[model samples]
Target chain A: MMHLPNHWPYIAAAYGLTIGCSLVLGIGAALRLRRAKTRLAAVESQLRHRESSAS
Target chain B: MRPTPYLLHRYANPGQFLRLARALQPWLSTGAIIFLTVGIVWGLFFAPADWQQGETVRIMYVHVPMAWLASSCYLGLAICGLLSLVWRHPLADLAAIEIGPVGACAAALCLITGSLWGQPMWGTWWVWDARLTSVLVLFFLYLGHIALIRAFDEPARGQRAAAILALAGAIDLPIIKFSVQWWNTLHQPDSITLTGAPTMSMTMLWPLLITTIGFTLGVAAVIFARLSAAIHESRTRQLMARSRLNRSDRSAA
Candidate 1:
């Protein structure tokens, strides 16, 4: 097994923070996009249904 | 590539942007995963430790990328601001709104990671050096940008206000870049630059380059994703308002 270097904890913490923040921001953006697209799709489909029924 | 009318002449329209972003996302995300994984693993395990800084130098793989991204993100923001102010591009306003928080996150991480790396090397978690102080200002600037972008009741007014702030905030970026050379600060000078050969070794440089590319891809993915959401939500709002107007006319008739 490879020996770990001194001050490994700091290194670990830094990596953890970088990875964590990136994931949170990335996932949050993806979710917002998903929600907005879904809402837009639902409204568009609803309007389509209403228009067809009216005609 | 910037989404300015100058750069993205064909894809400046939101619909064109959406089609392109959706097509590129899978490739971007997949490439981010691959490069980040390889780069991190190689930097942590295979890359030689700094002859001086030892294993702690591994932090640079992450720290440098965040630092670069934070600065580059702001540059992108300033460009978007210019686009908004000069051309009155609605997409530029939308892009600015989305870039604000992500850039802020990058700046915050750069500060935190720098602190983490500092404790082991500099023997303190914090310092008031020019490089450090300038970056702190950048963090605040990002926070201010985010807040200012949402300050006004009218979105257009808020965008204009934020655009001016972004332009003003850009001054700090050069200071952050040259701080170490200009002052006898505790922070070290840059290892890489466009004008000169990199001081860092080939082994370390490869991983750093890969990681930088990976992080950049990640940023593009997030910003594009957020911009997509904003555009879709705006469309949804317009559709809802039109539907309500049509219903009101029908009832009145």
Candidate 2:
């Protein structure tokens, strides 16, 4: 196995930052999508209820 | 055969785009995770250390791809801006808006990682080099877009203003690309070239390429997911407004 360099901390920091930022952005986008879908569903269901009562 | 206007219109429709995004999201997100895992492992452990830079070379894996996406995303935003302005394509505006935050995030990553890499190599954490400065500008442009988009009372007006800003900011892309060649800078020139073979060896090159592909897929997935959310939000607002109108009409009757 190749020996790890003394500068391993730098390597770890770089990867950590990259992965950290990526996870934040990815999770944030997912949450936004979920919220939007929930809102849309609620609005749609209310519309359906109104239409049925009107009929 | 060229796509007809009807085909373009159909593809640009939010409902059609949402359907396409739903179909592609799973595959894109999964592929991004797989490729990123494989590439990062290979880059960090298996790839040979640079003879000069030693272990610090590992920073290139993340920094390079982030830098690539930072610029590429802006290019995409500019194209979407043009489409929105000239063709009045609502989907283009939506894409531009969604891309702003993602591109800014990528650009910010690039700067941070670049600084980390530079401190050990260049003996300084930051510099006013053309390449670095232009990237900073790119990040600010993204922030400007995000701020402009939310600045107006009417969303349509905000979109129009942001689209114009996106188009104007595109002038920075080429400057960022050719900065090293054009200026005397501590930053090195491009390792990968369009017209000739890459300067990097295969072991280093392969991981970089794989990581780039993974990052690209990840960016695409995020953009699509955000676009879907934006479309849904727009639809919900429209529905709420219509419902209010209907209620007022019934009361009047």
Q: Which has the greatest TM-score? A: 2
- CA deviation > 4 Å runs, candidate 1: A1-5, B1-9
Model 2 off-target regions past 4 Å?
Answer: A1-5, B4-7
lDDT of 1 by residue, B1-253 (tens): 7654566556568999999899999999999999999999998899998877889999999999999999999999999998888877768889999998999899999999999999988899999999999999999999998999899999888889999999999999999999999999999888898999999899999999999999999999999999999999999999999999999999999
Question: Per-residue alpha-carbon lDDT of model 2 for B125-178, expressed as tens digits?
Answer: 899999999999999999999999889999899999999999999999999999
Give the number of the best model, judged by lDDT: 2
Report every candidate's CA lDDT: 0.92, 0.93
Worst lDDT 10-window in candidate 1 chain B: B2-11
Candidate 2, true inter-chain contacts retained:
0.81
User: Candidate 2 DockQ score?
Assistant: 0.68
lDDT of 2: 0.93
Steric clash count of candidate 1 = 0
DockQ for candidate 1, C-alpha atoms: 0.74
Worst 10 residues of 2 chain A by lDDT: A1-10
Write down the C-alpha DockQ for each prediction.
Answer: 0.74, 0.68
